[model samples]
Target: MSGTERGGGSTVDAVRAWRGLAETSVLLDGFHALKHALRFGARVPVALTSDKAAVLALAEDLAPDVTRPLETLLAETDEATLRALVPRLHPTSVAALAVRPSRAAQLETLARLPRTAPVVVLDEPRNLGNAGAVIRLAAGFGATGVVTTGTLDPWHPTVVRGGAGLHFATAVERVDADRLPPGPLFALDAEGEDIRALKLPDDAVLAFGSERSGLSEGLRARAEHLVSLPMRPQVSSYNLATSVGMTLFHWASTSGRPPGTGA
Candidate 1:
């Protein structure tokens, strides 16, 4: 099969399309990533695999909902050619390029009002993997979005890979602390109102500090309430992503609506 011919196009056409969009597109590195992205309505222009049959089989077993689209989308190429395109080819031997959502669109999403779920804010997070995990958590909890304050691009490839293509499931963007969405700010800290005693509101803006530091002075200043997760005396702090997961869970428990159900 010289590139799983489809729509009168061959591997050459797919490779050319991949190259054309490589710089401007988000790379869906593996079968699962592609699967999740497609489920969330990502615009995947080109999907390549060394074994189209295997990819389709995996999809049939794991995500039958997307199987037809995968069948129509996937283009098979030689393993060597596929590896050349993606240096670190995934074990599943599938890769694709998806259009990255525009920053303007994401900003609009983050700014939308009447939010039925809390928006998770990562204050100056330093770890790419942690940022990705937080995005995944936000998607799982049906949070309004995940906003990062700092230099790290939340949409970086490493972060996206960590997110397993769920970036499409939730709104994600980087913004200055002052520009965060409209909500009652709640910053997590060691010394604050005990989280157990306070019911986190659905539209709350839950902010967690970086791994090395608790909270930035700017973020702390903006917070209307300082919330603390329960901890024993000796423990210093929780992981950034872990802290987010707990806080969002707390909000979901009290919101009287199921997570991801949408208000």
Candidate 2:
């Protein structure tokens, strides 16, 4: 089999594999996304690129660690075919399909005790982009996981795109507020205690409300403590992702662990 072959099969076989797995797999769009996913131990079964040589060059320059794997996994295909496989072909002209982590495994990770990092919770977030950004932030801060309550699928393709393949770096799941892992729930609210005066615990469940409305009644009821981010009096609220970033920064700053060092 040639390097251009689909993990030992032909291009046709690669297309077939993509079609077979598209519905079940996570779409890793663009070179950076694929690189991040591969670095984080995501199982990429199929990867396609319009220009395998160029992509290999990119890996050589930016990600020497995954260069060999890219050489083996990337199947060269025509631009039109690549476009057909993905709704929008990334500017880098590379895309891949990665196996979504099992829900049971993520839940197990979330439920484990003595967590060294906080778990971020989005209370009924309405924006897919915000959810994705939060996941990215959670992954960056080495948070235990990112949990979302309400309708938005934490693993939605749009969210995945926004996350830039960092979802595999941390646990992500859509669970109700009651199902959140073992931790003291510190819900973010304008009326709560000033965050600067408090020391966020490693096992804290940092919850933020939706963009339009504040925390849902159910989540607010479950919260043991309410915390507030510092803001000017006239400002309404921080963006969902921004709030998560600030909270995680505060946690990491005081937790004695560098960001990105998982517990």
Candidate 3:
């Protein structure tokens, strides 16, 4: 873990393997992204680093839990090699390629009954950064997973970057409004019930709309209950990410034990 002359294969072999898998694999763009992904059980086939010693040191100091795997998984390479692998180099200069989770597996998890925490729904979200942020928040609060009903791929590179590789922590997938799993659908809207008054159930399907249009008519129709965040006065709406944060925070606080407290 100290030098630039470690890891399984030759630099050329490693680079070739990376290039071959680059299009299909999930790119862990930085040290933290790689760290989180590894901690959460991402199958990292190849990892590249310009500075192994420093990266391991950072891991040891900040995330000691992942230090050993980082030492094992990281393949030291030249700056040019690392740069060529990724579009823009992160400040930490560490990158890796991890296998994406099986969509069928994620769908099965989502479809399971007696869910312990809410599944956050992003109805036709437009922004990648917002989707990533919401996914990260869902992971933080121990929500079951994030389901997006729209054209946006929740696992897109930009969204994954924003999520900081925490997608491995929870189920993430896309489905139509009608295909959403069985649950009491509670859609978030401006003119709905005040969130403070209701106790968000552990098994709720909490849905939030896009930043631009709010909840869509189809989503609204699918919703069994429509809830709202408290607004002061003239403010039209909150940013999609922040709105999700507030709603999940409400769920966690009123949840009595935790977001995913077991029976």
Candidate 4:
């Protein structure tokens, strides 16, 4: 597992010969790539590098297990060769699947989940950190998955780091508003009905909008119910993630729903 460098296409061949989805994904060239891989806890199956010294040095320091020495990993390479190398590269046991979805559609995906102990969706959310942190939080709260609309790539290096390893375990689907699965949709809005007083349905799709605009007109219209979290009159509004977390917690406490149970 230490600084052992195997030479030639054999190392590349060894990586390419791997059968299952890479238990780990390793990125070459930049720090962001490395950061994302590390954040997801993906095993560094092999290191592809132009700088042999640098590659060996990196292997010595960071990834002791994966050290496949290859020339094709250098900066200048063709797609055919890269494609050939990809299968061989092993991803970690828990792979971080990434997606970049549009604003409206991501919202729609959120609008589709079952209300009973389901996933969280953020529609047309602009903040990258909020989107990433929310995905991470959703995983932490034991939500089934996360849907994002109008935001950065959840698997983007920065977002992955923000997720703090939560992204790998969660199903993040990027979809359009029109494609949302049919269900009881609810929106969290200040003007909505009191969450405590309202009778929450057995199954629901809870959708939250951005901080400034709140839920969109179309989203507001689609919701079967509009729910609001009780708060101090002096407080203006909760952060998007905070609001969603509150609603999730509220449902968890009130619904008597078991974890991973669906509507």
TM-score of each: 0.95, 0.96, 0.95, 0.58
Clashes of each: 0, 0, 0, 14
- Candidate 2 local lDDT, residue 160: 94
Taking the tens digit of each residue's C-alpha lDDT, what string does model 4 give over 133-174? 787677665565676656545555455555655664455665
RMSD of each: 2.9, 2.4, 3.0, 9.5
Candidate 1, residues 188-242, lDDT tens digits: the string is 9988899999998888889999988768998998899999999888988888888
Show model 3 residue runs off by greater than 4 Å.
Answer: 1-7, 259-262
Off by over 4 Å in 2: 1-6
Kindly list the per-residue Cα lDDT of model 2 for residues 37-128, writing each as its tens digit: 98888888899988999999999998999898888898889988888888688899999999899999999999999888889989899999
lDDT of 2: 0.89
Ranking by lDDT: 2, 1, 3, 4
Off by over 4 Å in 1: 1-8
**In model 4, where do residues sit more than 4 Å from their true spots?**
1-116, 199-202, 257-263
